[model samples]
Each structure stands twice: as structure tokens, then as C-alpha cells.
Target: MDAQLGLRERKKARTRRAISEAAIALFLERGYDAVPVAEIAEAAEVSKRTLFAYFPTKDDLVLHRFADHEDEAARVVRARFAGETPLEALHRHQRAALERRDPITGLCDVPAVVAFHRLVAETPTLRSALLHYHARSVDALTSALLETTDGVAHQELTARLGASQVLTVLQELANTNQRRINEGRSADELASLALAEADHAFDLLRNGLAPYA
Candidate 1:
């Protein structure tokens, strides 16, 4: 029974990948807005109903790739090693991600990944959808922070504020990396600088901005 279930899940994953790949290929060829959902459904060889079942909205078709990362910050915080601060854990993760050329970190210069970034940047709907997704990510991180035994007054507000600042810093870091990549800088070329910037950013988060004043 477990084997059967595993096989079924693998099949579903393949189907989803097929649909996403087809949709992205078409979107890259002809602008995202110009490509219709029905066309994507047909290209994926799935019924429109099946496509909708897999991805509820057209925006989702593009953003589905990001779903796995929605709670990444929260997960990192929750899984931090004993005695490690949340900021430290997140900073370590960001460094590792950049080292691995993780697409989410904007350090990947793969043609497809670069194209994906371009698609999102150029599409208004995808940007709006991403903002909603970021909000959820911040909320998840806040909840994770609240779970930790960090004693402070107004815990909820502090958690939310901290999560917001951390995520925004990371987002801006990624945006900067992506901009440099888009300008033709290789990930290998930017590796040292990226790590340094990440260290500095996390230090500011850890130590507060009084140093800059």
C-alpha cells in the first residue's frame, strides 16, 4: 500500500512538473499575459479541470514553484541547532544557499532560473501574488519566533516586527543579487562579495542599526 501511494505521488509530481515546464516555455516564448490558461492546459496535455485541480489560479501556475520555500524561514528557525540564535541560523542558511547557487537566493545564473526571475519582475500579477506569499512567509516566521522561549515584553508585536525586518532584509539581498546576475555577473564571480554582504546584513540585524548612526 505504501509503495502504491509513493508511486501515485511520484506520478502526480511528474504531471505537475510537466505542466509547469510547458507553461513556462510558452510564457517565455510569448509573454505571460499573452499566454492563455487553456493553452497552457493543452500544452501540458491535461484537461483544464485537472490543471485547475493542481493550480487553483493562473497566478499559481507561475508561483507554484515557490511554494516549497513559503515557510523556509520558519522552518530554519524551528530547526536551528541548540544555542544558535534565529538570526545566526538564517544567516548561515543564506550563506549556504548562495554557495549552492540556490535560485531562491538569486545566486543561480542558469538560463531558465534567470528567465524565471525576469518573468516575475516583468509581470504585475505575479508581483502582487508574490507580495501575498511574502506576507504569509512573514506570518509563518513570526509564529516560529513566538514558539521560541525568547523572553521579551509584547512578544507578539516583537515577533512580528522581527520577522518582518529579517525577511525584508533577505528579500532585498536577493533582489540585489538578482540585479547583479542580470547584469551578467557570474555566481562564481559574486560569491565572495555575496557572503560578505550577507554577513554584514545579519550583523546589522543582530546588533541593531545604531552603529550606522
Candidate 2:
């Protein structure tokens, strides 16, 4: 029974990947708005129903890769080691990801990845969808923050505010890197810039902005 379930899950994952790859290829070949679900389904050799089963909307086909990272901040907070604060855990996770130059973190300046960033930025609907995803991530992180703090007054409000700052910094870092890549900067150069940016951003979070208050 377990073997059958594993096989089924693998098959579903493969079908989803095929559908997403087909949609991206079609979108790149023509344009995002110009491509239809039917065309993508045909390209993937799947029925429209099957394609919709994997991805309810066409935009999802291109952006589904982002789903994994959506709750990453929350996950880090929840899984922090003993004696680690939520902010500390999040900063360490982000710094490690930057050191590794993770693509999902937008530290990668590869041409194809940069093109995809440009494509999403150029499309209004995709940009809105991306924003919505980020908003959801902020909400999740807020919940995690509330869970971590003990009996703190206005914990939910504080979490929401902190999550907003964290998300804003991350978004700015990603956009900056994307812009540099668009301007034909080298990945090594972008990595250096990102490391510096990450340091300053996390430092602000760590040292509290009380002086400005």
C-alpha cells in the first residue's frame, strides 16, 4: 500500500512538472497573455482537466515553484534550535542561503533565471500574484512569531509588524539583485552586493529600530 501511494505521488509530481515546463516554454515562445491553457495542455500531452487538476490557474503553472518558499520564514521560526530566538533563526537561515547562493532566494544571477524574473515583472497579473504570495508568507510568519513569544502583550500585532519588515527587506534584496542581473552584472558581483545587503538588513532587525523611534 505504501509503495502504491509513493508511486502515485511521484506520478502526480511528474505530471505537474511536465505541465509547468510546457506552460513556461509556451509563454516564453510567444507571450504569457497570448498563451492559452488549451495550448499548454496540448503541449504537455495532457487533457485540460488534467492540467487544471495539477494547476487550477494558468499563472500557477509558472509560479508554483514559489510555493515551497512561501512558508520558509515560518518554518525556520518553528524549527529553531534551543536557546535561539525567532529573529536569530530567520537571520541565520537567510545568511546561510545567501552564502550558498540559493536560486530561490534570488541571489542567483543566471541568465534564464533573470529572464524569468523579467517575464514576471513585465506581466501585471503575475506581479500581482507574486505580491499576493508574499503577503500570505508574511501572514504565516506572523503566526509563527506569535507562537514563539511567550505571554507578550500585543504579540499578534508585533508579529505582523515584524513580519512586514522582514518581508520588505527580502523583497528589496530580491528586486535589487534582479535589477543588477537585468543590467548584465556578473553573478559573483551580485553575490557580493547581496551579502552586504543581507548583513545590513538583518542587523537592523537584530538591533531594533528604537533609536529612530
Candidate 3:
């Protein structure tokens, strides 16, 4: 029975991947608005009903790649090394991702990755979907932050504030990295600058905004 269930899950996952790959390929080739859902289903060799079953909405077919990263910040905090503050863990994770040229960090210069980012950025509907994803990420991170009290009053509010700030900073950094790479900067060239900027940003987070004030 367990083996059957595992096989069923693997099949479902393959179906989902096929649909997403087909959708993205079509979108890239013909533009998001130009590609019809029916056409995508046909390309994936799945019926429209099956496609809809896996991805409820058209935007989801593109944004599904982000599902794994939606709760990434929260997961980092939850599994942080003993004695490592949530902020420390997050900063370390970002630096590591940059070092590895992880696409999430926007430091990857692969043509396909650049094209994928461009597609999402240029598509109005996909941009809207991304905003929704960011909100969910903030909420998840806020819950994780709440568990790591920092001796502050109004802990819930503080956690919410911290979560928003942390995520916003990271997003901005990724945007900068993406922009630079888009403008012909290699990931290797940006590595040091990216690491330095991450360190500066996290230091500010740890030390507060005293100097600016």
C-alpha cells in the first residue's frame, strides 16, 4: 500500500512538472498572454481538465516554481543552528546562496535563468502573483520570528516588523543582483560585492539604525 502511494505521488509530481515546463516554454516562445491554456495542455499531452486540476489558475503554472521557496525563510529560522539567531541564520543562508550562484539570490548569470526572471518581471499578471507570494513569505517568517523573542515588548508586532524588514532587504538585494547580471555583469564579478552588501545589510539589522538617526 505504501509503495503504491509513493508511486502515485511520483506520477502526480511528474505530471505537474510536465505541465509547468510546457507552460513556461510556451510562454517564453509566444509570450504569456499569447499562450492559451488549452494549447499548453495540448503541448504537455494532458487534457485541459487535468492541467486545471494540477494548477488551478494560469498564473500558477508559472509561479509554481516558487512554492518551495515560499516558506524558505521560516524554515531557516526553525532549523537554525543552536545559538544562532534567526537573523544570523538568514544572513548566512543568503551569503551561501550568493556564493553558489543560486537563482533565488539573483546572482546567477545563466541565460535561461535571466530569461525566466525577465519573463516574470515583464508579465503584469505574474508580477501580481509574485506580490501575493511575498505576502505569504512574510507571514511565514513572522511566525518563525515570534518564536525567537529578542527581549522586546510587543513581541508579535516586533516580529511582524522584523519579518517585513528582513524580507524587503533581501528582495531589494536580489533585485540589485538581478539588474546587474542583466546588464552583463557576470556572477563571478558580483560575488564579492554581493557578499559585502549582504554583510552590511545584516549588520544594520543586528545593530539597529542608530547611525542614520
Best candidate, lDDT: 3
Q: What's model 1's overall lDDT?
A: 0.93
Candidate 2 lDDT over 1-213, as tens digits, reads: 999999999999899889998898788778899998999999999999999988999889988878898999999999999999987898888888878877666778776777777788899889889987898999999999888777887888888999999988888887787777778787687777788888888888877796698
**Who wins the TM-score comparison?**
1
lDDT per residue for candidate 1 within 71-189, as digits (tens), equals: 99999999999999898899999999999999999888998999999999999989999998899999999999998746888999999999999999999999999999999999999
Runs of candidate 1 with Cα error greater than 4 angstroms are none
Tell me which residue pairs clash in candidate 3.
none
How displaced is residue 124 in candidate 3, in Å?
1.2
* Deviation of model 3 at 133, angstroms: 0.7
Task: Find the 10 residues in a row with the least total lDDT in model 2.
Answer: 103-112
lDDT of 3 at 170: 94
The lDDT-based order of candidates, best leading, equals 3, 1, 2
Each candidate's lDDT (Cα)? 0.93, 0.86, 0.94
Q: Which stretches of candidate 2 lie over 4 Å from their true place?
A: 210-213
TM-score of each: 0.97, 0.94, 0.96
